[model samples]
Target: MLTVDFDRLGVKPGDRAIDIGAGAGRHSFELYRRGADVTAFDRSADDMKAVAEMFAAMELEGEVPADARACAEVGDALELPYADETFDVVLISEVLEHVPQDVRAIEELTRVLKPGGVAAITVPRWFPEKICWALSDAYHEVEGGHIRIYKADELAAKLTAAGLTIRGRDHAHALHAPYWWLKCAVGVDNDDNVLTKAYHKLLVWDLMHKPWLTRSLESVLDPVMGKSVVFYVEKPVVPVAAR
Candidate 1:
């Protein structure tokens, strides 16, 4: 499911965008459909391979605009392969919590974004994530699993320190919090729990149909218990005289 609001991010056709840690290429695929020159970057070669296949499939199916382009790159987020100011937009969602050197990755994000360009970043919201941790150690205690939970203001401060201006912030997937809590309570790996299974089915249905009742409910609940907190930030463009 999409987290960043592209309309708020002001992504338009021809924008050079990258989705860092693009696990399954969800956001990257959206970017191509929005007519962007998009790159899906991840450390996992297997994931990148899958993303490449999806990109080719999208192109073949005419799912993306004619002028749009997409590719996948496998790399470290702490050291993106591109040069300075290479992208008009950058996105990293649900990724930083897993990186031990998250600040370095943020700095790399600042370095690669063009002046005046925007980036959308998301992390698990503090309270909900805390609940998950409290409910079960297994929820996060695994290789490549979440290593930390972020408080919104703390994340904003880190971005500011990295020279990105915080433009906006919001919470998303409010309806998802309880479902995760249930899974954590029952067992992180146990889908056989009747209540958990029922909740999972409900979530899948909500994802597929997005009925108005659930949509409106989630909108109301997001600020209270949203699973993910999103930030929109911009790199300052120096005036000619200042430069």
Candidate 2:
């Protein structure tokens, strides 16, 4: 399921967009469908390879706009390969928490974004993530797992310090919070637990079908129990005199 709201991010046709740390190209594929020139950049070679294959498959299937382009790149978040002011839009979803130098990663995001361009950043909400940490270390202690929790205000301050102005904010995936809590309770890695398995099935169904009941419930509960918090921001356009 997608975390960041593309509408809020202002992704338009022909926009140059990069999904930094794109795990499986969910956002990148969405961007392509919206007619963006998309780069699905990730540190994982295997994931990038799969994403590249999917890009080609989508092209063959005519899923994306005829003019839209998409490619997967193996890259580092802390040191993006593009030149400064490269992309019109950037998506950094569920990635910062895994990076030891989150600020540097944020800086890199800012650096690659064109002046006045927008970005959407998503992370696990503090309360639910805190509960996950309290219930099980295994949930976050593994390699590439979340290194630390981020309070909403702390994250905002960091982004502002890196020259992005916060434009909007929202929470998402309220129904998924309890599922994670269940996993943490039973055992973070225990896929065989009856409750966990049942919950996973329900979530899968919800994602695939998005029935009215769950959709309405999630809309109501999002403000309170949402698992992910999203922030939309813009890089300030530099004045000619300042330049």
Candidate 3:
């Protein structure tokens, strides 16, 4: 279920981590479970409230470490509320395409990460996303839908320009791509279409069961048709002379 691989990102216990654009707090919950002091930041107040409640529920169920702290904050990505160099780790997953000024948002993410801190960013990969756009205007033309498609190189350049050094990269969720194509071909909003409904059921089963066959197939397909591309980056420590 995680697009950003935490092990590859080097997430550790006690790290101060922020999940920017943390819709539904999936990544935030994972961070908390890993014993991070986690913050789930988003623009939606109602979503933040739900996230906060979930964090509290996790605490009550002893799912999180006693010392692990987490909270939800409603905020703008272009203007993060935290001070510069505050967090040890940052996660911006499936979010950049929604921001018109994505570069500014990247700059803000970089500014808040402490020097040497790492971030994991994920986005919809170009070819699959392009296919979705071509199939359905409703997919991209919605009120808060994706605004742009990013070629891997273009995204890497933008992050480099913002002073983050790319450390690693990978593709994920190859099995889910065709399901989306089906949705777009039917109707993005049409949940009742037989093909779309069947595909959705299959995806749900794959998620819950994670059978070896589908997993193996997805691994084989990931490099070629993965729906999302992930980048791991680090903010370099400034030399004393520069300071």
lDDT of each: 0.95, 0.94, 0.96
Candidate 1: C-alpha lDDT: 0.95
Model 1 spans with C-alpha error above 4 angstroms: none
Residue range 1-243, candidate 2, lDDT tens digits: 999887777789999999999999899999998999999999999999999999999999999889999999998999899999999999999998888899999999999999999999999999999999999999998988899899999999999999999999999999999999999999988879999999999999999999999999999999999999999999999999999
Better model by lDDT: candidate 1 vs candidate 3: 3
lDDT of 3 by residue, 81-156 (tens): 8899999999999999999999999999999999999999999999999999999999999899899999999999
- Candidate rank order under lDDT: 3, 1, 2
What lDDT is obtained when candidate 3 is compared to the true structure? 0.96
Q: 23-84, model 1: which lDDT tens digit per residue?
A: 99889989999999999999999999999999999999999889999999999999898999
Per-candidate total of colliding backbone pairs: 0, 0, 0
The TM-score, computed over Cα atoms with residue i paired to residue i, of candidate 2 is 0.99
After the best TM-score superposition of candidate 3, give how far the Cα of residue 8 lies from its true spot, in angstroms: 0.8
Task: TM-score for candidate 3, please give it.
Answer: 0.98
In model 3, the worst 10-residue window by lDDT is 195-204
